[model samples]
Structures are given as C-alpha cells and as structure tokens.
Target: MSVTGERLKALREARGWTQEEVARRLNVSRAAVGHWERGKNEPSYDTLIRLARLYNTSTAYLIGETDDPSPLSAAQGRKRPRSVPPAGWGRLTDRQKEYVRRVTDEMREIMVKELLDGEQ
Candidate 1:
C-alpha cells in the first residue's frame, strides 16, 4: 500500500486533467483533490470508488497496490496469456521469440541512452 503523494499526482497528471477538473468529476472541491495529491488528506470510501471509476483504474492501483491497473482483473471469461504471437510472429519458435526480445531490449537500451545523451 504505497499511498505516496507522487503516485497520486502521477495518475492525475497522466490524464491531463486539472485538480478542479478531477474535483468536478468526483463531485468534490478542488481543494479536496489538491489535498489528496499533496498527501494532506485521503478520500473517503465512496470517493475512492468514484476516483477509481473516473480514472479507469482499480482502487488498489490508486493506493499503489499494483502497478498494473488494467481492467482485465475484474473481467469475466478472460483469456489465458498466449505464448504464441497473434499472426506475424506466430510462425516463430520459442527460441526465435527469445532472440527477438533480446535484440529489442538491446536496441531499446541503445536508443534510450542516445536520447538521454541528446544525440541523434
């Protein structure tokens, strides 16, 4: 239960909404929303539910229980995780997927470093 102020602020910022906007949606005052993001106060149970719905997230995520707030958790008749890719990569073997993942990871690291260094 990582109820950090920064996490709340991050979630709010990800939606590109102002504190007043969130407040209006949650039917609360802007000051109340500000307080929640500032770690000065916590929302009530009903308010928490409202916030979760408004943010399209789980209450656990809002309180920082898990990083994945995908609505799939509550979804019924959900499909199992598929090891085989959908179409293009479906023909590849497991070893091939591993190779692809390794190469992609390496490329991602290189690109991230280059961007951080301000290089083209």
Candidate 2:
C-alpha cells in the first residue's frame, strides 16, 4: 500500500474508529475509506484537506510530502526563517523555504485586510 494508505489506516486505528465510523465522519462511503486504505484510490484535494483536518494532521503528512504531522496552522506565527530556525535559514530545505514563503504571504494578506478594515 502507499504511504498515504498506511498513514490513513494507522490514524484511523489509533483513533479506534471502524471504517464505517471514519466514512461517516468524512461523509464518504465505507467502501471509499476502504479504497483509500487499500491504495485503490486517493481522495480529491478537498477531501484530502478534510481528512487532514479530521485527523489533526497536515495535508503534506497525509500525502507523504512531509513527515511533519503538525498542520500549517500550527506554524501560524512562524512565517519567518528566523522564527523556524533561531540559528539561521541554512538548515531549511527548499520545501521548507517554500512553506515559509507561503506563510509569509498569507500573513501579509491578513495584515493588509485587517489594516484596511480598521480604516473604515
């Protein structure tokens, strides 16, 4: 099975949930969950996002893109390399750099929106 399938099964088992229970929570059929666990199929991006949220994990972790289970939200204030690595940015991978960039962008957007709203 794929890493995603393995992780999904492990997460479900860890929660002591039956396939039916997981399916119910995900608003999918039991067979769909089974398929996901068996690596017969993968969830759509939205469904994957839902799964990550439901499991309290990150989409990257669920998809085997990263081993970190903590979601991006967990790093809500970690938009800078200085925050992520007090030492420096040299330790960051390309993927981590990209993640920092994305977080910074999101934070900037939110700050702009809030500032504009306060002006009203």
Against the true structure, whose lDDT is highest?
2
For residues 2-120, could you state the per-residue lDDT of candidate 1 as single tens digits? Answer: 25355667778998989988888878899988888887876765676577668776654565434666632422333323464434456655854564455435534644675667753
How close is each model in CA RMSD to the real structure? 16.9, 6.9
Q: How does residue 10 of candidate 2 score in lDDT?
A: 95
lDDT, candidate 1, residue 108? 46
State each model's CA lDDT, in order.
0.62, 0.74
Clashing pairs in 2: none
Top-TM-score candidate index: 2
Clashing pairs in 1: none
- Total clashing pairs in model 1: 0
Off by over 4 Å in 2: 74-120
lDDT of 2: 0.74
